[model samples]
Target chain A: MWSINYYGNWIMHNIEITDLKRLTQLVKDNHGYDFTNYAMSSFRRRVNRILDLYNFSSVNGLIEKINTRPAFVEEVVNEITVNVTEMFRDPSFWREVRDHIIPNILLNHQSVNVWHAGCSSGEEVFSMAILLREMGIEGKVKLIATDLDNSILDKAKKATIPVKNMELNEKNYIRFQGSETLSKYYKEENGVAVLDPTLIENVSFRKHDLVRGGIFNKFDLVLCRNVMIYFNQNLQNEVLKKLHESLFKYGYLIIGSKESLIWCEIANKFIVVNNEEKIYKKIRD
Target chain B: MKKRSIRRSGIKYCKVVGDLGMSKYKLDNTYRAIVLGGSAGSFQGITKILSSIPDSFELPIIMCLHRLKHVRNGFVEALSIKSTKPVTEPYDKEKLKKGKVYLAPSNYHLCVELGNSFSLSTEEMVNNSRPSIDITLETAAYSYKKRLIGILLSGANKDGALGMKAIKDNGGLTIVQDPNECMIKTMPESALQATTIDHVLKVTEIIEFLIELDKNYK
Candidate 1:
């Protein structure tokens, strides 16, 4: 009953709900990572993908490996946390940030603090840095980017991307209407796009878990876009509260276009800045 | 070719074939949702199917149509213009309603999670599709099991084939548009090849089947 056929050749086992619960418990007990709060269906999809990738026939095999190998847990963590992102995703949102939000923040403070929570391989951080540089305000902005996976954080620090992905990133940059071409920010070498090191000179990339990590500092703006969609409601409420605490009073928070804050615990504290782009301004602490 | 002839002859022909083909299966009013997956050349057929169904149709229609990743607007509005039920792109975690149409938003994998809500993902594209038909159908099958009805339409890719198979494996009813009638035969043909589909239907017959199913709800 567990085996199902796809593509006529492979008989993939369906990871049942009970198996998923067992796997989550095993990961929590063996490693310190807790995946219980992650949305079950999507998490199950990722775990299934891991099984297919590693050619494991059953969840028990994955659990046995986790029990034996200490280092393999990092790989599991990296795969579990999706890192799909692009530079200047939703260009109109970036335009709003460049024209309205950033300038508005600068009027009050000499320097602005920005946090890219779940930065995910640094695309958003680099995009923001490039934007700041374009406005001649790179020196006035402090950026801290963090993700749960240290492996991806290292890539974010390195600032290199596959050349194949640059076409879409450049297209997004054009749509954002940056002053200079996106080509000015990166060099193509050995089939990879090596972004200018200076693009992240002001960015501090760190390994921070949004679920487990404490509010380390207040921010003028926090971009936690697309990160909370993976969590169930209770976990989303917990993480939203942590994010609300991480922001300064009246600071802006931008989530993914499809994500909403209306159902969260702190819904009353944030007023909609732009509903279409999912931007909100904190009205109270 | 005309609507009059289709209503006159097509409906009768389809009813007889449907009765014979589906005699083993019973419509026990257990179906929770209808999932439609298509890509490339499916818009017209989907519009036809949506427009033909009455607003009184009770089950929610979840769609995973491949679309432009960056162009986020107008698609749903365009689909809504002809649809009897209001077509929308559901926000992540939005609950599935009884008589609405939910389209998978561009550049995200739409999953039908347990507890009757949606969850979106930005995982790498499967079969080069972010709004992957397989992901949506598989997850819907996971949630609805035997209560799910999956319909596959015309497309150039083989994405929906495995999804149709998944639905069949979950004891759900499966239908695919007749390959000969499809603008692109690859999709429905692949589905036909992948699993033992309950029906291989023309667009008009598919509409008749749905209208009949809706009557059971009333």
Candidate 2:
């Protein structure tokens, strides 16, 4: 870990360290967002990128501009927490979920609660909803979409996607062999597809921090995909335990395709389901 | 792309000596192993070729790369999006199992020891990088011997040559990225100089070779 040294008060200017400290402090103070635990190297990269973009010679100059201009702060925060995702990002994984995993859950449980822990911008939540609806268990399902970013969550609540993304997502949906046409799920207005509000009715889009504990009740399936990869192993294990506690006996846990339970202390507890897809079914005595 | 037969280089010692003999029996029947090495500009290409392999591939793969120190982001996650095979950075004392990929962790040199077990060391950086291609290839040469297949991919420095030589010295197969096709040719070029490279192919052709090797042996 590279630690940036701070000289007491004001001695001279080490603009890089100063900018990182100032922005980090600002995030904590303004939004109660603590990015302090994030990997220092990645944090430094984003900090330097923002500093270069604004061409600020000093951290104080950047601070003054951000305090005066809220949009600049928003951009900085947004840059630090970029979430890139797509609908049914891995079609094969989703296929496993839709074909092999969901049927078992339906067979075992009368009702299911699926949690998308880091449900950034809601593409996956909708995808999950579509999966349940296709299985004829839409009404019996409750999907909780959660993210730390309220702004992104607010955008997700609207369920309106860009015209370009909708076209691409339509193609993706078709490739995944979704039973319904993409147009059936949403109405278009001026090239944008406004997703049907009915689809997310049972789905609650809320601001929940994974770092904070014990919000949702026990869930039958938890799809926390591609989110834990950013966390260190300690955090990954911590979150896995929390997710484990949130799962009912014999519940299912699915992770990103690359992520696995092997070597994890929790591996003994879950039976592997399509290890390549990283789908696991919780097995408890 | 040449019809010329590329024969294995050097004097063929008629007698496979000691552990090499044992390893020859173990791997003489096996021709598939996943090999990964990287430097700058490797993200997209690595993922593309890896994902092109089948998810159910039965051979073990070893991957080495230079990672920026102290980044917690999942290099495996980004690559997994492009690969059908499951990817993971190896843990200390993790047994070298088949059908999985083991990546070198950041700031660590990942190597294989005897008995198909992995060893990680934070020893002084080689070639100015902890995940030096030389360290991995050297260790693999000692462990897998002829069972190994080494790949030298995009890199800014000549780090993999000594390691590639180790692989060659142990009678392992070697492949170098075509200098004209590599994103960074230095690493592959160095390996080409250090040993008699068996294949100098594009990324796509390498993928095809791997698939063919996987099918042919397993």
Question: What is every candidate's C-alpha DockQ against the true complex, given to 2 decimals?
Answer: 0.48, 0.04
Model 1, B1-218: lDDT tens digits are 36445544755665676666652234668899999999888999999999999988899999999999998899999999999888999888898989989999998999998999999998877777888998899999999999999999999989878888889999999999888789999999888888989877789878877877876787
Q: Interface RMSD computed for candidate 2 is what?
A: 13.0
Candidate 1 Cα deviation (angstroms), residue B75: 0.2
Error of 2 at B189 (Å): 15
Question: After superposition, which runs of candidate 2 have C-alpha atoms over 4 Å from their true positions?
Answer: A1-31, A52-76, B1-218
Local distance difference test, candidate 2: 0.70
Candidate 2 lDDT tens digits, A1-285: 011111111112233444566676786787566665543333443454455556666667777887888667666656565455667766767778888877888887787788899888888888887877887889888888888877888878888787767765776687678888878888889877788898888778888778655556888889987666444455667778888888998888988654667757787889987776778888873
lDDT of 1 by residue, A1-285 (tens): 011222334344678889989989888887888889898888998898678767788998898888889789899998888888999999999999999999999999999999999999999999999999999999999999999898999999999999989999999999999999999999999999999998787689988888888989999999999999999988999999999999999899999999998678899999999999898999999
**Best by TM-score, which number?**
1
Docking class of 1: acceptable
- Indicate the residue-level lDDT of A130 in model 2: 82
Q: lDDT of each structure?
A: 0.88, 0.70
Report how far off residue A284 is in candidate 2 (Å).
4.0
lDDT of 2 at A223: 91
**Candidate 1 residue runs with Cα over 4 Å from true position:** A1-11, B1-26
